[model samples]
Target: MAASLAAKVHYLDITGEIDVFEHASSLDGEARQANILLCPGVGFDVIPTDCLALALKQALPDATSLCLGFESHSLKSPGTAKTTVEGIGQGTKIRREATIRTEPMGVRARRIDFGQGERLAVAFPWGDVSTAYKTTGIPSITVYVAVTSSFRLAMLAANLLAPILRLPLVRRRMLASAGTAVGPDTEARREAPTYLWGEVRNESGEVRTARIRTANGYDVTIHGALAVLRHIMEMRDFDPGFTTPALLCGASLIEELPGSGKIKIR
Candidate 1:
């Protein structure tokens, strides 16, 4: 039905342990922005002096901390499955393997200009799955992709990743640490006020930011795991080089609704 008809939900998959990246942003009144806070709901036993956010800085050198997540659901069923995600593919930087779900409708993204009530200039993809953790609480990561012309956000991501992905050396450098990254060393906490537009808020309470370098141009800001996830997912979904990521090359997750993804903390 979706193939023959217009699919309500579009799915974009990514591969290889994608790196966490970030960019700086300026918000406009209604252009669509997201806010993220640390999940007070989650806790880990290791309780290292450093938190997941700190680790991301070391692993994902070129990422900013942003709070926009994607929803991935089957075009057939838009009722279930949704997730609060960061980026895609064993996103070790943020400490999630497969932890979040996806939503049917694309996120209301930032407008090209702030005030006019224009539609989304960027279309972030929906996160597909959520990875669970055992000893260290429930850490996870979600992925998204924007392929179709209808999704403008996907296009912007492509623009950014271009220079980054253009050189094989950089891509190989990040992808080298696929599954075995421990995280970043403890560092002094920086106090930065998150600059945002729209409904975006910092759910985690403490606001932290970093300067990231990517295959494409890079920006530094206060968006954490979620925003980095979005950037990578969109890049693969829209780019020609990594059109079909390595992860989806073999098996794929079942079609579901938003928020359905889970990482059982048992």
Candidate 2:
């Protein structure tokens, strides 16, 4: 499994600093040295952006300083996906108006260094777990999935399709069909309220798992963020690589969910 994941790790470099963020302030000496910024992926629904921002503000007032966002371009679409990279200081708004290009990984931005103590944040919307692990040297990372009966099946399918998607011919064929839309009401697109399936790992190592469901319509991504925040707040240590939330915080995170949310841990 480790070997398989290692195969997907692509190292690419960005040349000529493209102003990806609109209002990024120059980091002071202290902020550059010790603070950690949460760089979440694109697509709002897949990640609990607002909740995470709020949680970081309330919980780790000192360490947490910046939130990073990205603009994702579709393989088929002509225009770029405009995104805002919001910073905490002076409400700094760094916006990426045009798509930033990078080699090897196609449209996705490559691993960026934010000086010392920077973590490449991971969550549900961020699908490429191996890439994040390789890019960010941070040992413990949290990944969340919205687990429903169908979504679990989707994950199984994704696991199976992961390798197949790497095949040159198959990837080429799929990219050609990228813009083709499936019917919304199709079984594959069915909607259901989902609980969070959280996993923490490092490299190929699997640390722990947590399943959380909330009645207040909070998806697992929020808890995923909370789990990550709690993990950072506790100042716990673990093997450096990809890791799950439970591995860092244990079953207590599962117990902290609001109302009658179903909680399970392993």
Candidate 3:
């Protein structure tokens, strides 16, 4: 982002890193002065959920709490595996009253219906816990993903060994193994689909629920990045400085992706 600002070029990345967003936000003044856009999370990490959050907010302008969940059949890429390793031992994060807070990973669990049957979902430190609040003024936010029984058991074990997992040696070993992983094959990527779910509630108890199904993660990343690039190039005027995918391109951007199904809301 710094280099992009220096060169007076727009910057975009498919990162779910909270620090990256914070750093880019800190440069908002510089980016605005240079008339450059610094947009991030233009992919699977936050695009669908971010848009859903905003849509829910639009449905209930006084919304105060939000919950987002997803179920992805896509295999983890090498980069994603490494990023997971990097987050080892880090507890789950959620937004409370518009502030980021950390808690035990498996502490929160609920049933989520991702436009299909209900499944067990566990809270995690997903990117939207940070980005969603920025997209919508909804204060309380939690992001979750569908989990199998074994995965939930692993989360319990992770909570028990959190301190040990944070050790440099342990993390390095895990990272090494993650680096060796080969991601999904062409057929696997083509067949796998990603499902997203979101709900928002206001003080009056009104609720809005929505869901979206998209192509595999890697495909979404590729197409979303290009779509954002195209939108940026064809724009006459746009928000300068740090922004998010839905904020920059509108919530309809997700629906516009060639490989995504229309968002379903209730």
lDDT of each: 0.23, 0.30, 0.87
State the local distance difference test value for candidate 2: 0.30
- The candidate scoring highest on TM-score is 3
Per-model TM against the reference: 0.22, 0.27, 0.96
Q: Number of backbone collisions per candidate, in order?
A: 47, 17, 0
Cα deviation of 110, candidate 3, in Å: 0.6
lDDT, residue 63, model 3: 89
What RMSD does each model have against the real structure? 21.4, 17.3, 1.2
Q: lDDT by residue for model 2 over 1-266, one digit each (tens)?
A: 12223443211111111131111112222222333322222122223222232233233333212222222111212111111101001111121212222121111222322221222322222322222222322333223322234534444354445556557676555544543533222232223233344333333443333344332222333454555565565674544332323333443443454332444434
Task: List where candidate 2 sits over 4 angstroms from the true fold.
Answer: 1-51, 60-141, 182-266
Candidate 1 residue-wise lDDT, 1-266, digit = tens: 12211322222212111111110101111112122111111101001111222233233333323222222111211111111111322121222332333332334334322222233333333211211121112233322222234644444454455566446675455445443333222221122111111111133543332221111000111122233334444544431111111121211111011111211110
Of candidate 1, the 10-residue stretch with the lowest lDDT total is 40-49
Model 2 alpha-carbon miss at residue 122, Å: 12
Q: Which is superior by TM-score, 2 or 3? A: 3
Candidates sorted on lDDT, descending: 3, 2, 1
Candidate closer to the true structure by TM-score (higher is better), 1 or 2: 2
Q: Of the pair 2 and 3, which is ahead by lDDT?
A: 3
